[model samples]
Target: MMSRIPTDAIRACVEHTGWTEQEVRNVLGNVIAETPDALLEALPEVIAWAKRIEDSAALVSIMKELPRGVLEITWNGTEPAIRIRPSCDVRQVPEGWEIVLPDEKRHAST
Candidate 1:
């Protein structure tokens, strides 16, 4: 998948979103140039298609209604989807937020 951080796309997002172009450019450029592994690890979390984490309260309600266990959230990004293992007990998901289930223990994948 093509990354959204391409120069023209980033410039577009900045102009469309009314964000500081300089800030966006610096953050995007530095992440691409400095720490590749960190960027790879976090790419799934903050892609262009992530259901804007800006709406947490509503998401909490949605999570509360869904049956407990693993949920796969498909968003637009290079990879296209992210699977989250949320804590079983959560009633409402914090909106615009996908909190990593606190009790989730990451087992090394083979």
Candidate 2:
């Protein structure tokens, strides 16, 4: 039987990133399925990224473009970065900031 997704983790993601509950579930579900604790484990970095960006709408758009799988948050350098397995392509928004997006969204109407 499949295990349920953790509500606390979902809440954290939603609170920090401004993504709807279903969006959070879609983004993190695959990773949580592979590793039950993955969402909780990654929550800190996710929150950090959200705080660093300080734009809920942008974060929501970015999350929407990510593939439906493991969400990877990295802090190996001066800033935090997020990506998913089989990394997506990136494009610059009108504000001149680059953001990653799945292939479909790469050319879809913004």
Candidate 3:
């Protein structure tokens, strides 16, 4: 699999979607600059595809229905047909329990 980021493709996707180019760049500017063209092209397509089915309400339903478990993505070697399954087992973390983490590990929280 290619490991480079596709800057041009990402820009095109952002532009096509009417999102501010500067905002997207501000978020992924550095990585996009270093990404491979092929990867960049693929990334935008993936984003567009994801947006088509971006169902926050469905996600909330899933979370409510399976409050005890976690969602797992099962890759099927396809470009955009990945499956997300909720774990059979309940969440490892108990309800009402807070997870502690170091301040340095705060990245990706958003």
Model 2 residue runs over 4 Å out of place are 1-4, 30-34, 46-110
Clashes of each: 12, 0, 5
Candidate 2 global lDDT: 0.60
The reply for model 1, stretches above 4 Å from the true place, is: 1-7, 33-51, 54-110
Candidate 2 lDDT, tens digit per residue, 10-104? 68778877878886665554443335566566756755665455665666687677545335677777755765545554467898755465666
RMSD of 2: 13.5
Q: Report how far residue 64 has shifted in candidate 1, in Å.
A: 20
Model 1, 2-95: lDDT tens digits are 2544566556656754557675555455454345556545544544433254345556666666444545667686433544554433345657
What C-alpha lDDT do the candidate models reach, one value each? 0.50, 0.60, 0.48
RMSD of each: 13.3, 13.5, 14.0
Best by TM-score: 2
- TM-score for candidate 1, please give it: 0.25
The parts of candidate 3 lying over 4 Å away from their true place are: 1-10, 26-35, 53-110
lDDT of 3 by residue, 16-105 (tens): 656676655444443433346554655665555545555545665655653232344444675323233321322346564333333333
